[model samples]
Every structure is written in structure tokens, then in C-alpha cells.
Target: MGLFDNAVPGGNITKPLMIALGALLVGKMLSGKSAEQPQEAPAPAPTPAGTTSADGGLLGGLGGLLDKLRDAGHGNVADSWVGTGQNQSINPGDLGSALGPAVIREIAQRTGMNEQELLQQLSTALPGIVDKLTPNGQVPQQHQVASAFNS
Candidate 1:
């Protein structure tokens, strides 16, 4: 459960649900292993400077994830999650395509979910979770996001 275990939000996401997302996009990317098994994995690849937050931790990784979604032709969907207005929905199939097969397979392995179930859960929960994380229509600072997670 790594960093996110101590950082579950009390908003649109539940602890049980979001741990996988956190691990999938943040922990796994940064640490090269599931949050549940940090010690078992090799050292993580280094992130280039400025690719993330000041500390280059979870919030930064989350931002990068949003960028990935945007780059994959889902900017509107990702933007809606961070905007002040209504949240937009994404289809599970579309989400899977955006994430690509390698990521899907990796996350599926880490979370012990099939690709379809994983995409379904993420599509259902991601909008509200992103909306909650971006309460001011902006990505929070690393410290702010960390605090939110811990609260």
C-alpha cells in the first residue's frame, strides 16, 4: 500500500477502490512495483527533472497520468475531471485504449483484476475521484495533494 495507504481521500473514492489506481499510475510508475510489494521490485527508473512535482511524488505522478490521458486523445475527458464544472464520463473500452495494452496488463497483474474489470472500475470511479482531487479546478500542489490523501 506504500504512500497511498496513508493517503486515502474521503471523497468520491474509497480506500479499497483507489489503492489500485494509486498503485497503478503513481506507485508503479515511480517505484516499478505495486505499492503492495515495494521491496520485492528492483529500483525504479529515474524521472527526468521537472517531469513531476517539486518532490516528484504521487501528485506529480498523478499529473503525469492526466497528461497521458490527454495525450492519448482524451484531453476533454481528463480536463473535465479537473475542471470546476460537471465531470465527464469515459467508456471503459476507451479508457483501456487510452491506457494501452502494456499498462493494462501490468495493472491487471498488480491488482489481480482482468483488463475489463479494471477498466470498468477505473472508468466508473476516475471522474469523481479526479473531481474531488481538483476541488479548485486546478491540480493541487504536492503537499496539498499529500495532505488530502492523508486526511
Candidate 2:
């Protein structure tokens, strides 16, 4: 009988042995080709120029100065309403008004939120917005004064 025919039908012996022999043949062929292939060497890292490294101290000092300036500005606004006894709600627009249009626009752009929505969130988060803008913790009367003078 032939090599495969000697094995019983539906037996595990012939099938597994054939598969393993085929796999070994393929492995041998691939390994022979891989051994003749040339391997590429890794490139060396680039060296940084200049004698002194970049100074982060200057940037840190500038950042600190900016923080101090921001704190001072907020403090000034808070101080403006220290004696005010009014309970008026501060809106988003009020905060924007206190900070100016440029700052309000910048904040809106950076946060990816609408100006009105940002204003509303700030109004809820920081009730101090109204107090800082007005003596009575309400919308400031400056708008009316400006309108009157303009008209």
C-alpha cells in the first residue's frame, strides 16, 4: 500500500504528519533566503549645536510675572466692589465687559465655546464678576452714562 494508504481512514497520524512536513519545507526555504539578505545599520542621533543649553529660567520668570499681573488685575476688580451690598446676579457679558472685548474673544476662541455660553458658565462659576464690575454688585451704570454722553 502507498505511504498514506497504510494509515486508517479519518486517522490523526497521516494528516498531522503531512502538515508538519509541509511547514518544515516552507521554513527551510524562507530561512535560506533570509540568511543571504543584508541588514541595514541604524542611523546615529543628531547632536545639538551651541555650547550652552536653552535657558528655561527666562520663560519661567516671564510666566510668573504674567501670573502676578493677572492676580493683581483680578484683585483690583474685586477691591472695586468691597463695600457694595447689592445682590444682583452677574452675567457672562458682565465679566466680558470687565475683562474687555479682546480678552473675552480670546477666552471664547481658546475654549471652543460660544461667547454667550462662556459668559453664562462664568456667571454661574464666579459670582464675583458682577460685584467687581459694579459698586452694587449689579450691571454697571457706565453703559447708560456712555449712551447719554454719545447721544
Candidate 3:
């Protein structure tokens, strides 16, 4: 399947929603690189927990994040973020519980927004972005997300 398979019909670009996805991926890549590099000097600030540096790790971690949502009794909402369909609304309160403090805080830092504002943005954007990522109605692999970035 093509990248952005779940984008809005009529070929609308999903770029705006990519913010959360991009932040998650960047968290993974940056953390992974630091892990690989044996830094002798004072270590850089770590990426938040629940993030990894591997290319696919970000998507996988996001899938896990969705799972957390489901496990938190929001399966229907989580499912809405997966396929190319009308994305259901997500409650920021619920999303916050699923994302955890560290991850949320880190994302806020990465996006240069305050936590409350970041949460609001994420609640609005994540479903569409994740739907775009999982064009095949399933979680995409690392390379797929990478190719999407390049494309």
C-alpha cells in the first residue's frame, strides 16, 4: 500500500497531523543515537521513556501506546486511529493517561509548547496521523515510516 493510504479522500495532505508522529520518531532516533555513541562528557538529556531510537521502534512504540489506550478501556477510540476512515474524537484526559507524564512532557518540549497546549494538539491530530501511518489497516514497519518521510 502507498504511504498516506489513510489520508483524507480527495488527496488531502496529512502533513499537519504528522507533528506527533514526527516527534515520536525523532525521540526514538535521537535516543538511539545517543545510546550507540559512548559519550564520555556529561550525557545529553534523555528522550522520554517509552521512546526508542530504532526506526521502526517509534511506530511499534506508538502501537503500544494505542494498546495502552485500549487497555485503559478506550479500544473503540484507539481503533478509530488505525484505518482510513473518519477518525473518532479522543478525549485529552484519556489521551493523557495513555501517553504518561514523561512521554507527554518530552513531546511538549520537542514541540516547544506547554503540556496543556500540546495535549490539545495531540488529541486533535494523532488519530489522523496514525491512520495515515497505518494505511494497510495495520501498524507499519520502520522502513515504511522512513520511506514515508523520504517521500
lDDT value, residue 132 of candidate 3: 73
- What is candidate 3's TM-score against the reference? 0.67
| Candidate 3 Cα errors over 4 Å, as ranges | 1-19, 25-60
lDDT value, candidate 1, whole model: 0.62
Per-prediction TM-score: 0.67, 0.29, 0.67
The whole-model lDDT of each prediction reads 0.62, 0.32, 0.60
lDDT of 3 by residue, 86-107 (tens): 6888888888877678777755
Compare candidates 2 and 3 on TM-score and give the better one.
3
Q: What does candidate 2's lDDT look like per residue over 5-34, in tens digits?
A: 322223223222221121111112122222
Candidate number with the higher lDDT (1 or 2)? 1
Model 1: per-residue Cα lDDT at residue 149 = 46
Task: Judging by lDDT against the true structure, name the best candidate.
Answer: 1
Q: Is candidate 1 or candidate 2 better by TM-score?
A: 1
